[model samples]
Target: MIKVGIVGGTGYTGVELLRLLAQHPEANVDVITSRSEAGQAVADMYPNLRGHYDLRFTEPDADRLAACDVVFFATPHGVAHSLAGEILDKGGRVIDLSADFRIRDPELWAKWYGQPHGAPELLKEAVYGLPEVNREKIKQARLIAAPGCYPTAVQLATIPLLEAGLVSADDIIADCKSGVSGAGRGASVGSLLCESSESMMAYAVAGHRHLPEIQQGLEEAAQSDVGLTFVPHLTPMIRGIHATVYTQLLDDAEVDLQTLFEKRYANEPFVDVMPAGSHPATRSVKGVNMCRISIHRPQNGKRVVVLSVIDNLVKGASGQAIQNMNLMFGLPEATGLNQVALMP
Candidate 1:
């Protein structure tokens, strides 16, 4: 079994990891750490996992985590900065589901995250863990930085167009909506049920932190600097992200976008390229590790609209983290992640 340790097992992403790993055949949840909820039984906090995990939350101890084969950081952005390096130093692979090591530039990461990066020394060594794009790199990486919820949906939708040189990289718009869970398991006036329900408002329109990560991925696909306007809205649901991306086609040739996306993700296990003209709903991917995408060219015009959806906590965070772990260990990417999407 692949021994596993998780830091910050109290948040939506953390528990999501435990929930998924519980069903994984080759992965074992050896330790899960949380500073505030230390000593509490994992099931007491999350009733859904009551029968699945007997583990308790413990205060993060580097030496304790070092015993595991792999450690996942499902904490807030800077939290992983303090522990990731130590665990890696102990000869265990590390996968961070935070922004700590996702961006290539520490200065840019600090500019958006509002603090000096705690582990700048490890920045150069961290691999961006998007299995569709970096599968080979993840196989050899000792450290992996999983993409955020927003970036995962947006990038998967736009990368194919940008790489095929069929869309305008300079002018791209990613209009995204995410469920309340994306805000995390924290208390906030904005996240309150009364405040968030029956109402949808866009925050971080000026520039979301995920903008740079998305830009970084798109630029890498386009092989040039990219201009993207990413606006995130908080929806009333509990899981998933729906990104409606609009990009003007650069060439007016008879481009087959459906075929383009289908071929682009033909071999990807987690990405589902839906039939042409299909609108992927966020709920279709709720509670599972899947990205459902559809491509369209409106009225055969020079504009393409791509719709992408995924469970933010699954394909966006913890599930993708585990996918990286599977790659790092040479296991089938779908091993512990074959659960079908939960429906209403």
Candidate 2:
């Protein structure tokens, strides 16, 4: 079995990791760390994991973490960098679900994150972990920087258009909405039930941290700089992200948008290309590592609309992290990620 350790196992992504790892045939949870919740039974805090995991939370210790074959950093952005180098030095691979190593430019990362990067030198070595785009690279990487929730949904929806040169890359617009869980497990007035429920509003319109990450991925796919207007909204739900993407078609030719999406994701195990004229709903992908997409060209106009949906906590975070781990360990890409989406 591949021994696994998780740092910061108290947040939404952290528990989601535990929920998935509990059933992984080749994975064993060796340690779970939390600064504030150390010494508490993981099941005590998360009753859903009671029968699956009998482990207790511990403080983040490099030595103990390095002993495992791989470590997953589910902590906030800055926490992973401080401990990743030591784990790597001790011959352990790392999968970080934070923004610490996602962006290539350390200066840009520092500017958005509001602090100096803890390990700028390691940025060059950390591979961006989006299985659909970087599957081969992930198999050989020792450090994997998983994509953020918003970027995961937006990029999957629009990358094919950019790659095929079917759309104008300069005028791409991604209007995305996410559940309150995207804010994290922390308490805030903005995330309160009274504040979010029955009310929908956009935040981070001026600039969201995920904007640069999304642009970076799209630009790489298009082989040129892309101009994207990414705006994120907070919905009343608890989990999922719905991204409505708009792009202008370069030619008025009769192009099969459905075929384009289906062919692109034909071999991908996680991306679901829905039927033509279908609108994918966020709940359809909840609690699973799946990105369901639907493509449309209204009134046969030059504009194309792509709707993408994913569980913000699963496909958007922990589930994708485990997918990268499976690739890194030479296991089947779907080894532990084959769970069907949970239904009501």
Candidate 1 segments whose C-alpha is farther than 4 A from its true place: none
Backbone clashes in model 2, listed as residue pairs: none
Q: lDDT by residue for model 1 over 93-177, one digit each (tens)?
A: 8999989999989899999999998899999999999999999999999999999999999999999988888888899999999
lDDT of 2 by residue, 138-205 (tens): 99999999999999999999999988888888999999999999999999999999999999999999
After superposing candidate 2 on the true structure, give the runs of residues whose Cα lies further than 4 Å from its correct spot: 252-254
Q: Report the Cα RMSD per candidate.
A: 0.9, 0.9
RMSD of 2: 0.9
TM-score of 2: 0.99
Give the Cα error of residue 203 in candidate 2, in Å: 0.3
